[model samples]
Target: MTVSALTRPGERDRLIVKLAELDWVFILALCLIAGAGGLMLFSIAGSSWTPWAINHVSRFLICLLMLIGLAMIDVRVWFALAYPIYGVGLLLLVAVELVGDTRLGAQRWLSIGGFSFQPSEIMKLGIVLALARLYHGVSAEKARLSWWLLVPALMIFLPVLLVAHQPDLGTAMLILMTGAAIVVLAGLSWKIIGAAVAAFLAIVPPFVMFVMHDYQRQRVLTFLDPESDPSGSGYHILQSMIALGSGGLLGKGYGLGSQSQLNFLPEKQTDFIFATLAEEFGFVGCVSVLILYAAVIFMALRTAYLSHSHFGRLAAAGTTATFTLYVLINGAMVMGLAPVVGVPMPMLSYGGTVMLTVMIGFGLVQSVRVHRYAEVTSGKGSFV
Candidate 1:
């Protein structure tokens, strides 16, 4: 009682209370994965990364600060800003189409001064927030048979179609899945999900063969049999598989893999980071990485369930599924089980934009968990 009585009540108390309410288990898990990512990036970058590492470390610091700031904000702030944020994001996408940076045959980034950003990443955040707003008042009767579902779909679809126009299939698919997960979590029926899946499967074959770019179609066909063109279309997959299998049981140890050292594995620090982990740490390491991902996803789903408000719940769920898809696509691509779609491994990938956006998403979910019941007085309803 004496110790409790000595404490003062203020912002510090509010901060402490919020911290106490958070899911530390999930936070710790994410931190562990992030730390591992930094270490792996060091190895991948090697002697050529002195400046790159410093800049990336600075980016990580910035990401951490943004996370803290976001986590302390009320959940309703995101809802209030959702539509405007989405509108701004769409405008940026349009700007991207009109006057954007074209690199490696994709017009996905916009450069300002010395810095560049991908509008697709911003759109990912926008779609999640926007969809959460739409699903906030969903009920079984309304959710099952209402135009509300279409509203969210259209919100998501516009950006996805634009990203696909950028010819960035990976991001477009990720955004689509993120929106679909929100719809499903909003209590859309299995009948709907199943039918949607069936329609997608039926439609994809024709699009792949006729509409997709030549190299993109090659990626899909090569995944089915990587050895078919070891010198051409399948080179990346074959090399990655060899590197992964070469690691054997424990691993070849860090910074010692011939595949990466000899420059056989492409995009070693970015899209193919998991392969770097595999080639250095082997099966045990891969399992450890998978376990960390599973833990984060599990806690994220739990956070969604425990959230006090529908908006918070949907945001948490959609964000969790987005993370899951990021990990799955990257892992499968590295293992030669899926086509090379340029999906970056969460936390581990070397891109600053992807890293920052992912961390912000994490912070947003954490904020939702911590401040789920906080009162909103800025033109939105308050819990108090």
Candidate 2:
């Protein structure tokens, strides 16, 4: 083979160069996190890939492709599709109400062509995009306590209510926080922010007393005192705490975590997966993993800060907030610091839908990076 022939470019070579514009650091960080997930899954499967490991890796690879494809598209396309995507997400939420699948006494899952789908996951992104799109055109001056705020408030609350209706409080809280952050970023005044905070604090008591279901109320009570029950509403937390504490500084080694290996840990592959990691890998492993997540959030926030376009800024920041909240909430739950709300440990937790949504968000973040110069203004006329 001639060197000239090897160096020559065709469509495929050109495409490769184009895709290389992507931020490789962020991509590598994601791969490392996913690799940790696969390893953890393997450990959970008794040092095998037959069950969770291979599936997690395969899903991650598939989602990585989706990420690249999304990155390659014009972010303006994302901006333009924001509201439409939000609308579709809303419809899916409605579909869940009509014919949705139920698991664990919660009507949150949806079935589509033999695939388990969750519309609330989609709304996580859709709401961010919609808020970004909504505030994209409006001047910051008009966003603060104006009648214009009503539309964005509705955009947020509607999905939040729908998700809450699914009884998926974790996801609902995620959506609500994402919307609130975007509005704040859009420059909602501090006075309004303070009042909103006060209002939320004011509502918590009544909401917990009157709004929460029996089990949900039990969870809050258990969070307050897990030792009180030890084996009922508090079983998961107590067991998780024991496993975490037993891991000590260096952990029990892979596939040797007594809690999981001895069948003492609950939800080893899902919500409490972090506890499993802490059990096997110990505090050092957990901290190392957290540093990685911190780096990811830092990069994401930096992307948002640097993007000239308001849409890119809001979407990127909101997505980062979602990821951060997921990690924080799940970590706290496993460590007995917060209520167990079924929030997974991001890539470390096994879930096809959440993985896809996270990767897609990073893909959009990469788009912001690559097309940093490709600015789009706020308004319908700016849509491409």
Top candidate on TM-score is 2
Q: Give lDDT: candidate 2, residue 383.
A: 48
Local lDDT at 88 for model 1: 93
The Cα local distance difference test for each model comes to: 0.84, 0.88
**Candidate 2 displacement at residue 308 in angstroms:** 1.8
lDDT of predicted model 2: 0.88
For model 2, state the Cα shift of residue 279 in Å. 1.4
Total colliding residue pairs, candidate 1: 0
Q: What tens digits encode model 2's per-residue C-alpha lDDT throughout 58-92?
A: 99999999988888777788898898999999999
Tens digits of lDDT, candidate 1, 39-121: 77777667445544555666777887787778888888787888788899999999999999999998999988988899899
Number of clashing pairs, model 2? 0
TM for candidate 2 is 0.94
Candidate 1 least-lDDT 10 residues: 375-384
